[model samples]
Target: MQGSASSDFDSIPEVALSRIWQEGWLAPELRTTSGERVSVIYRGVWTHAHGPDFRDALVDIGGRIVSGAVELHRRSSDWRKHGHDADPAYDAVALHLVLCDDAHPPLRHRDGRPIPTVELVGFLSAPLDDLVARTGFVELGAIGHGACLPTLAGERELDVRAALREKGWERLFAKQLRFQQELSAFPPAEVLYRGFLDMLGLSANRQGMARLSELLPVTTVERTAADGGSKAVTALLLGCAGFLPLSPGEQALAGLTPAESAEVDQRWDVLRQHWRLRPLPSYSWTLDRVRPANHPVRRLAGFAGLVSGCAPDGLLARFSELLGEAPAAWETWLSSANPPFGSARKRQIQTNLFAPFAYAYAEVQGQHGLVDWVAALWEQLPGAVDDSVAKRTLRQIVGERRFPIRRALDEQGLHQIHHQGCAQLRCFECPIAELAMRYEQPVLYHVDEGIRQLQEEIGHEASHRLREG
Candidate 1:
């Protein structure tokens, strides 16, 4: 019993052996008394060596003393489970650690000799338990918090931004290609412009707007006719999707009863045929608790108005122009009561317009630039808002990972209401706060000057287009 207890102290589990290698614990060292003796013992039978595929084995404790090397796994049983016991590849295993002592089947070495095995339960239990306990509580949160600010400072931030930009550009170019493929067989300008609108709609109601667009066939109309033809298709689609209120004779066309108009149904059918629509996967449009101003129908109407006002070829230029103007000027345009598409909620409209631009910028310039842009924009948002709300909104806007901070800014101010109409949580300390700190002065000035320069460039470019015409 005393001799067995002395030998048990030196035994090691296969699982612990693998862990030792992975965690950098096992290094070749000498014991002074033993004069170059390795401390860790392994046991298995010797096999082949010196080739493209060489292997050996150190089976039981006595075998380890004879030949010193080991490959390990969670259990000695894995040897058979992984089929290494049968493969020529594992002929060189030097040690086998078993959780339970069992007579493993005899395996032949290259020279065709039976291999020995080691039992490690008593040797490994205490040390492995201590290791697991220590690692389980490692302070990851402290590390992340400590690194956050330094990560955003100086050239480190710039390098991150550059990597983000490259990734963003790749994503944008890929999307541009996909959009083109979606609208292929139509004119390039019509494809580009309508793709932009679809992206806008997708941003708002994802599945709903996509289903609505599929039903209306804006791209199909553009393909069959010319540029402006697609605008009519866009209106019809938006109108059917409840984005547009019935046009003057829409009720008559729909064959509605005294109370309700059938125009939506009839027009949906006609547009479907004209566009050669295919059946899309079914989805329900969400209107539950949605405000009238933020309604999909109203937003679609605004989109229609914008398309009607700017012909397809001029669409890009018009967008650049609007973006180049004062926020006040665009706000006034959006808020106009008698605008062609009818009145819309000013905030919703601004969000729909600005959100797409941010996505587009991120796609083109890279995520780091998007981070800067979002932070700059958030700094300019109304002051002292809820941080959580800002974070949620910004997440919807920019995305996660490449631009988590930007998404945080966009979520500000939105409140979730319970059945009893009570606000649940107060969220704040968003990306906007970060932006305010980072670019409060220089970014604002740059944006103001940049807008002025862009307006001039767009105006000059427009004159050139007119001359070409």
Candidate 2:
């Protein structure tokens, strides 16, 4: 194996470490820093949440089998630097794995007991660089031109758009119904808050973000902001979200000002104890290749600001009123002049959070006019995001035709079609497929056959993996 520079070890991504763990590439029988032998039983599920990297992992430490969370970092000092020491979420951590043991180990847990540490620098099956390369991630590939592209491009383009708009309305109604269902159980403020968090979470961390909102409810955020102001709100949300660093040194490294760092550290200490709050699990956030402007920490900061801004009445009342106000007012309230909270993200917040929620709340109160206003507003909101699903659906339906998704409603229509048709592999049943059949009748059959073949291939791949396991 080729040797790697120490700097290479420093730069190793946490996700690579996770991949390595998932593959069981490290030496099976290992020795912890305390001289105890360790053996893997079940490596556990890769929880892409806040607390531990791997959860429910079973391991044998010196003849005693243990099942708990497993945490990983590039360096052993990251345990304290990342503030896991102060977080009760790591209390059940059974084993600590690190690439380098720069600091002394076993590292102490929140309850003061030393966690068994395994330094992987010496135990890896291949060179560090090779392992890192092997663990590299790949995104979804491009889809080819579909059978319906030619016919849909000529006379049927307008008809296709109309079809999509109809589906978009269906998608909008579905979202409104989901919000109504949520409102029936919880308060409107809570439902809106959870939805906002889900939008902020984006694609990667949506589930984890929704889970965080549930853990720290809207009422708590409102009450905390009212009592302690923005500083307190910042500490509460970021701390609970597992973004606040425990030590002043880590805070400084995280680019926090001295006063800001002190406030967060001091406030979180009191808030965690008083509220009996637990931070999300380790590795809950997906930070790899994420732009800094869209980092979970930054989004949490934006949420903190929003919480403080909305104060006494909470998000529900404030945003409901804003629905009647100008778009500028909505932009200001959502972004607060932050560049990271750009127009695109704000548009998404509107499409996903505001419109459906307002419509749902209005319908429950018998405010039919207000519901209509929200539905109208949804149509006018410009499309800000052009994601993979929209692109893929476009390729399948229109080929290379430059049919722009100009509005949020159209994008929603694309997603609705994808979810209902492409994702379900129900090509023949799709409205788009029906539209395609009118032009090139064989297009629907070919598309349906292609989907069937893909499903069979997927089934075979899954069965092969199962048999190997």
Candidate 3:
């Protein structure tokens, strides 16, 4: 693909053109033939290998940051001529560049997946070879990170906290808006049940859990509840969730006691008669890199226990009543759950799921006072036990002073600043970024030993992790 240009745009060597892309010479916002914007973050190191022209490139296509290979071709069909079209090695390619769209249709992978192709013909004004000759490759780390740190270092401490608080409110309203949309269609009970299941899924299996909630609704599961013992509850829920082992070996049964195993099997039989629907595919649950206790089986058991314990009031009522009560009340119920959902997990669920829905429920029922109350409680409540974004933001803004945010609202606020501000590298618009601008050079900051230094500096660290049983 990298050869002398063949009559498409004069005889320009592609080696020079490849350097144009690798060094970020083209407009930062590249326009594809299909007219979508492609923003280059890191153009990646040029490779002399047999594959893509560039490797390890980071690009922002449609807001999602993609890291992969970038291929450059004089003509779109060169992809096929070079055998890259059918090569599995290029499977991770994120971008394809061509001088012209002389080929009838856009380029596709060997597997027939359409690769994003951007035509450089219209964007190219001067000859690329001249541009390459004029400008040498950009120096190391030209695309710098933490653009706002230099400015934020000189600001008063109180101003920064106030800005964070304001950003936190922005995050709350953003979440509330999303929850309002979710609640618009489904009934309160249906929405609440789905939300809880989705919460239990955490980051990995939220979609699977949501699907399970939809397939086996509260009404459907309510019909199956006779006594709804913990063993029976876990069996029914896990069976439906597709977490129950299809063929249990000794290793599969390692975590459960013999009594628990017998109880689950016995309860599963009862569920077989009441629940007539087929179980979901075993692959529906996420297991890779998941801790044992936080696995779908245990979360399902906890969900079943919560539903069984709070049945008469219904899941919605029990959950709603709990939000208004003390935080200890939520932890108390979590403590006795079938597989016992840890307090750390409960806090994540409470902040992400309950906070939004609680406000939405109150708003729908015309309880303005309740809506106000939920907002107040959300700000004071503790956030997730651990949030990666919070740690990242802390490192970005925290120069010498350690920024420790324990409250849910404060933590959520930092997330907004990170996503909207830091991720975008919008140093000027970001409130903290303004402070960072005071210095000509950005403050040098690094996450010291994974937030360990920050924890020691603040003298407070949430060290609670639910280890595998």
Per residue, candidate 3 scores C-alpha lDDT tens digits across 1-469 of: 1222546343444555676676665665877777778888888877644578889999887777889999887677766656675678888789888786666676777777778888775555456545645554222111124233534434465666677778888877877777788778878888888878888888788878877887787776654553675566667777776655433432142346666767776777767666675678867877798886677776776677777787666777777778768466766766767567877688877777777788888888889999988888877788641668877776667644555567777677788888886775443346665444443243433322323454665543221110000
Candidate 2 residue lDDT tens string, 250-337: 4433446777877787999899998999998857888787766566677776677777877877777788778787355787687672
Tens-place lDDT digits, model 1, residues 1-469: 1123423422433223444433434333322111223334432322212211112322224223544445444444455554555566456554443434333554446667554444433444345545434333221111111122232323244443333334333433344445435444554345445454454453446667656554644444334223434335444655455533454443333222324324444555565565555443324466566544444555554455555555453544454465545345556654432222322234433433343344444444456665455335433432222235434432322233244323212222222211001121111122222432343333334334544566687865433332211
1 or 3, greater by lDDT? 3
Note the residue pairs that clash in candidate 2: 49-284, 50-281, 50-282, 50-284, 51-280, 51-281, 51-282, 52-281, 52-282
Lowest summed lDDT window (length 10), candidate 3? 460-469
For model 2, the stretches where C-alpha displacement exceeds 4 angstroms are: 1-147, 246-255, 326-328, 337-339, 441-469
- Model 1 scores a C-alpha lDDT of 0.40
True-structure Cα RMSD, model 3: 13.5
Higher-lDDT candidate of 1 and 2: 2
Give the candidate order by descending lDDT.
Answer: 2, 3, 1
RMSD of each: 21.3, 19.3, 13.5
